[model samples]
Target: MKRIPDEVLDHIVEICNDEAALVVLSCASKRLRSRVACRQEAWRKRFERQFLQSNDSEQKWLHQHMRAKRAATHLGDTTSILLFPQGSAQFDWFDAYCERRAVEYRWRHGKYAAHRLTNTANVRPRGVRLQSILCAFDYSPAGDVAVVSQWLIASPRQSAWFSEPLYWGDMDTEDVVVLSKRQSDEYLVIQAWNMLVDCYSLCVWHTAAPHRPPRTIITDKREIPDVSLRGSWLAHRIAHSADTGQYGAAFVYDLARGACYSDIQGNIHTCCSLNATTDRMRIVCVEYNKSTSSPVTIAYKLWQVAPDRAEPMQCQATGRKAMSLKQGDIKLQRIDDGKFILYSRETDDLDPISAPTISLVEVVDEASGVLLKEKWSLGIRVMDIRSIASHDLFSIQQTYDKWLLLSLIDGSEVRRVHFNCWICSGLYPPDDQWAKMIDDSMWWNPRDDPTLHIHEEASQELSPAAIVYGHDDAITVVDYTGCMHRSEHQQGVERLSIEIRNRRIAERKHLVAEDKRIAAKRKLLLPEGVRMRTEGAHLRDKSKRMREEGEHIFTESMRMRDEDSRVYDKGKRMFTESMQMRDEGRRLCDEGRRILDECEHLTAKLQEIRAQIRALDST
Candidate 1:
């Protein structure tokens, strides 16, 4: 294996069946070790094959991974980080691959640290699980997001965050989180529901700079539900013409130049579903043909939207139609630049054989509106299609009890997790659900809306908490990013959990005492001769039982509180130590970042100098 040429070796490593064989091969010789494990090309291929692509700089992420391994050593979980012997460097590509692989496994297994939502103008999240999710708005697959019980907006592989500020506290359930296709993670459209106008006012926010105010993009008097923002262009639903009764679909506009490419008021208007895919879009249209009985048809057309000046919107049909849905649900989302994936169920209700089908189609024949590339995922009771990331791997709420990760690659359910709410699968219930169960009424402003199940199907179970957990509603923002920034906060979750138990016990005691007093007063009111001796003895026995129960509860509360105190003291000491170490880590990380930046600058400078030297040599 070591004697093979580098070109042959690269091919061998890329085509190697699995990582285990590669690890064993890497141990065979120093050449194998360098080529298979330490080299950039071999590891990059493995990284892409095994994990969700990260937008973070590979070098920076490598350093972060190194920091995590060091942290795990500090926390005494030394065995897991020791992937290889002395061979793994601080920022080796092999180590980077391993970290990403572990993170992916963390996502798959639903391993995460749950933190409650706090202010930044924020307190650290308390330890409790919040209610069920209404909707999740994800930025990337890296798990860097902000989740609210009202709505969920999550990302993956980074820290997740949500806020409860003055304005954002009012965003309604339908105003979804919209992320741009680019990796800057900037240019997300978050909406604020204005109840007075009964409309949603959408604003563009640079997600990284949350402390700054967002620039409002549109403020129409309607909640335009189907809005898509990609790169520099924005498309949404516009108001229809009142007099003509024509359909209305908002046109794309560039915010940088403040240019509107198409105006819907004067020209092209249609009741078509529109979603942006990079510089273009896949437009699906339905036409009702009068020639045949019950003749309804669906057609797919490519809609190319450019920032350059173009003629006003023109309504032109590519002139083809496909099968009409009798009763199930059909969803169309962008798979990439020119492709569209259609997920459909034959029946809305659950059936064993009639599973949801995913099709990758293009407008090859404008006549058929489909070039069928079928990938079928067989499942029952699919509640809704939540979000679809880049690789055609979509997340769906299966029976409203679990989030299943369905892949278009093999048309199978790759992973399913019951704990996390969304695609990133980072949000989870508190480590100790009862212990961390919180009363969040203080900040969680409740609204008197219609029923809880708004857009999706109503309750499958008749009870609310089964599908939509609304009791003790507090969210524990989970961190499965594994970047080593797990909060070593004090034992607030345990202490708070015990505190709630005590409150309930005290309330029970007060109610019992009040009932006894009422009974005694009523007996006195009945004349002294009317009171039976047997009745008096029975009342005495009941009072004694009540007293005994009260004493037991009091004793339990005392023991729990004592335990809570000891836990608090121990947690405080550990927390203090962890915080100190965390500071030291941050200081080191900042220095490392500076060095990396300098190295990048120097490398670029060296390249420029070499180019100049070549030019002089030519002269």
Candidate 2:
């Protein structure tokens, strides 16, 4: 066997589209692996372009054929209705009759006119010929039309077309510009025969202009990275900080400037959300230790953003002043003035009223720590407390005035209730109506047999649990279900679903037995286990039960098989129909061309005869 030349092997690898073949070629030799990896980008681009072109061509042919048939059948002028409210809800809603293209927008109160904004254009011919529609509509911060991008068909034959400029106006000026042929950041549209594949252009139009050329910013194609608007910011867990003793980082993205910053040193664990107050933003981080029973701890940190500066600086720790609180959760709500209300949860101790159960700390400065103004303790029975929302702390006059939702499990029944913090204790008696409501809501009924499980002499009983409310009235029940029941239910469901599936298999086997008799006369091999009828008693009994409940047991399986068969038949028919149509179209086009040629020849002969007659008359 002759060894292939290096150039030939390289060319084969370059043209190879199969991933498996490429993988094998990469392992052929060290030089081949390096060559393939280096040229991966080129191969990827080539494959993507080829795949997109073929896909677009098939899609375009189907669309154009369908549209032509629809247009020929329906004879009427289509109108698009642009509806704008007179005075009530300040918004614009467009209703296109023929194409069913619609969009709604809310108007800025005084900035733009609400009544005189209705505008319509003759889009019937355009819509009929349109193969695709490209739309980009986004409103600016002040409720102004920041951009509107659209592309339409220009002719009935669908041979030529143009794209409209990004319309930027609302109480502002409007602008339009014609697009060029070459692909650029300014304006360039590419059509894959019928469908507009892509439009890579930047049209910057201001709101204060009725007519003007959009400022164009062009860059080389190579310089543009594969950056999409839907792209996500990458996040990875780094090593734990030795200084702050936590595992986390701060993620900040500057949308205006298109830059991202990550602060790993600040010991940030969880970033709830961004606060848009000053240049700086706020993020939450958790600190924990394994030795403590309640090992998990949480804290909030404030970071300042300096646009001129490269990174955000940690200004201060807000939860530090509430030293008694072990930072279970912290919620920050911005209120009047430059102050923020901080709700921090502390460990509950007996004598709930005396012990500091919940703390509403006011953040003054990062250096000074938290200033605790109000403290509340429900009872010594309460073990843990957490703030549901930031507004929960500041809005309530008394700490107990806020509702504390709790979850309780009394050996059998699981109970969840939203009770006033002060009323959670048995000592505080409620009104007759409220008392009945509490009793009805409380767990009085048991689910499973209580006598089934005998408590082990050595094992300690699980403690009662409570629900902690977050800032948004969101409740988090601690250990909602005991480990035993949760595992039991999960296992039961898995077993049940599997048992039903197994029964389905048995029924299918029984059906195969019946099918085998029909095939036996045709001399087909009997599948394994199909002829065996009475071998195992247990298996026979199970199969008997399965046959009785076969309809319900194998409903899902039968449905799936039926769906598969239907899809296969549908695809086969579609392919056959498409091929038949294509053949008919080709034949018709050929016949039409022949007829046209005959007509042309006859017209030429008649014109020659008329010229001869004219010459005879003149003579």
Which candidate achieves the best lDDT against the true structure?
1
Error of 2 at 476 (Å): 25
- Please write out the lDDT profile of model 1 over residues 472-565, one tens digit for every residue: 2233333445432222222344355468768877887999999999899977876763556667888999999999999999999999999999
Q: Could you give candidate 2's per-residue lDDT for residues 1-619 as a string of tens digits?
A: 0266666766876777564466566677855654455453464453333222122122222233334344433433122111122322211111011111100000000011111111212232343432322222121111111111111233342222222333333322222222221111122221111113222333333322213454433212111111111111211223244565554454444433445566634444334322333344443333434234332343545544455655454555444432233444433433322333343343333342342333333334445563323222222122334322211222222244433342111111123333332222111111222234322222211122132221222111111111111111111111211112233433455466568767877887899997887778545533434455445666889888889798775897899999999999999999999999999999999999999999999999999999999999999
Task: Return the lDDT, model 2, position 169.
Answer: 34
RMSD of 1: 46.0
**Top candidate by TM-score:** 1
Task: Locate the minimum summed-lDDT window of 10 residues in model 2.
Answer: 101-110
Q: Give the lDDT of residue 422 in candidate 2.
A: 20
lDDT of each: 0.46, 0.35
What TM-score does each of the candidates earn? 0.45, 0.23
